[model samples]
Target: MAFDSLGRFGVWRGYTGFSPEEAREYEQLGYGTLWLGGSPPADLPGVESLLAATETITVATSIVNIWVAPAKEVAASFHRIEAGFPGRFLLGIGAGHPEHTGEYRKPYDALVEYLDELDAAGVPAERRAVAALGPRVLKLAADRSAGALPYFVPSAHTAKARTLMGSNALLATENKVVLTDDTNTARTVADPAIQLYLGLTNYVSNLRRFGFTDADLAIPPSDRLFDAVVAHGTPEQVVARLTEHVDAGADHVAVQVLGDDYLPALRTLAPLLAARS
Candidate 1:
């Protein structure tokens, strides 16, 4: 079985654009899964509605924060949904940011403990995934969960992760793609989108491992910095650029189109939707 039902590619939406109607279109458009980002509240009504709306698209939490929801609540939600949606759900759980969560310490150990709780609660291992970055988390993700969904990482990091996870594990990389064609202007807008992530330890650490220096990881991101993180240009050009991650070994790529207007961007990326199997 595919480690992730993602089965090679998906779309990453900020959760605002996932209307009932648009979701139906997304499934028809051939996006195998939809990764909902942000710390959406534990209820996950959005996820349930999405799973109900689409026939094939997998509705996943890019990460459901372990601190906020707790394993018992997540397990309850999983049972409620799985009974109705079955294979349409995938859980992506992680220990989130330090400043936001407060109890931030030894994320790996915390993550493992959380997974253990989920396991004890009877949420099957195959139905869930771990949000990871760097070698240790990647290894833990492969060893304990179905796979890893790494966010804000580039092809170089994907290549490195592929080595760590080995060939059997799922490598679903979240790549930021911009539909805007303008070089300087697009990068300018994309910079802010990436700026928040720059402060994230998981993201910054991954970039460091990928060989980016402090200067490169600086705020307001330099031109080269923007280019490295955001896949900008025409649809096909961006598609070709992102393909490098797949060539390196990513089993799936969740393309997050930047600059807010996702409907048009999703249309622009329509051509590549069929690539998912």
Candidate 2:
């Protein structure tokens, strides 16, 4: 997998909230890729919109949930996007949370089946990625897709993922960021943002692997857990934390800035990311 196409870092945000204008600005700011977070549908016109808005930036789904969107449909969407944009789109697929997905069965098996369908539908393995955390799924990502796209994890998890997937595969991890120097304010802003993941077993399990105790994963995440997951501080501080993933062998880091307004933070961190590149 050629991660150079994705550059060293990218912006990860929800598809619904952002505009084409903002995406173009990110491209101008020198970010390599733009990932649309959340479980997007199979017909990813949003991918088309972003690609049309930008010139060279790669646009990918942070994850398109397999339980909700069928693989054949997703593959068709992939082909449609590829035809129009060529090498600019990546199909990121996952078997989302069991609690949230009504039809969620054995996620690993379902993911394999979905990959099989993508293969049958002519979506090449290199053009797609899997959102994985555990060793089993991470190995599967290495074997089946381009690599693993692990979310809600710390730098330690990135190191473990790189070790599991080896050097050839892509290990793109998403790190949450809040541009603030005050610890209390940063935690307060991050608390609600992270509350949703606390109920999900998959994320909780991954956090435990990072040595987070039950107290840390409580309703309002403990400072230890929040600090570890969210890179909260100045632009330089956030860049330092993001670099931890790169040093740990991550191929790319998709930064998800916390809070409603993302432009100010993106503007603040753009130069820092570009400098690291």
Candidate 3:
């Protein structure tokens, strides 16, 4: 697998927030990949647009939910993108949460079936990844796909994922960043950002494994829980915290900046993260 093609650090955000021109700008800023968050559709034309805009930087879906998007259609889209932009696209797919999906059932089995279809449709195993958090799914990711893309997790979870996946599989974890010095302001910005995930069992269960208690996982989330999951500080401090993920085991850190704009945080972080790379 050419996991090295995706550099050590990348940007993560909603696809709607960026344009083709903005994607080129992120590439120029030294980010190696652009992860489009949210469960995108099977026909990933937006992914194609980002690929067309950037030269070397990779563009990937944070996840294309298996329940909503059929494997055959997704495989067809993968072929379409690969024909025009070969090594620049990575398909990240996942079995979405039960609360969000009306037909959610046996996620592991569904993911296995989806992978089988992708394989039959010729979507190379090395070109795709699974959004996994638990050990069972992480092992499945390593056994079936190129890697695992875990979201709403801390460095502790990243370390666990690496141990579960073994050394060979790629471990790309998302780290939320809020650029600020004040603790109250940082948590204020980050609390609402993760409000949706706190209610989700998958994410809450993962946090529990990391030692977060029921009180910590409350509606507003304990301060310790918030701080641990979201890196909030000055630019240099945020970089330091992000580096902890790489130190723990993450091959690539997909940074999700929590603020009104993404470009400013990306610009501030580009040089610091690039220096480490």
Question: TM-score for every candidate vs. truth?
Answer: 0.95, 0.98, 0.98
Displacement of residue 202 (Cα, Å) in model 2 is 0.4
Candidate 1 vs 3: which has more lDDT:
3
Q: Which 10-residue window in model 1 sums to the lowest lDDT?
A: 1-10
**Model 2 weakest lDDT span, ten residues long:** 14-23
- Expressed as tens digits, the lDDT of each residue in 1-277 for candidate 2 is 3689998999998867557898899999989889999988889867888889989999989899998888889988999999999999888999899999787799999999999999999998999999999999999999999999999998999999999889999999999998999988887788887998998999999889889999999988888888888998888999999999999999899999988767899998999999998
Q: Which stretches of candidate 1 lie over 4 Å from their true place?
A: 1-4, 273-277
Error of 1 at 66 (Å): 1.3
lDDT of 1 by residue, 130-179 (tens): 88887899999998888898888878888888899988887788888877
Q: What residue runs in model 3 are displaced by over 4 Å at the alpha carbon?
A: none
The TM-score, computed over Cα atoms with residue i paired to residue i, of candidate 3 is 0.98
- Residue-wise lDDT of candidate 3 within 29-101, one digit each (tens)? 9998899889888898688788887899998888999999999999999999999999889999999898899
Q: Candidate 3 at residue 121, lDDT? A: 99
Candidate 3, run of 10 with poorest lDDT: 14-23
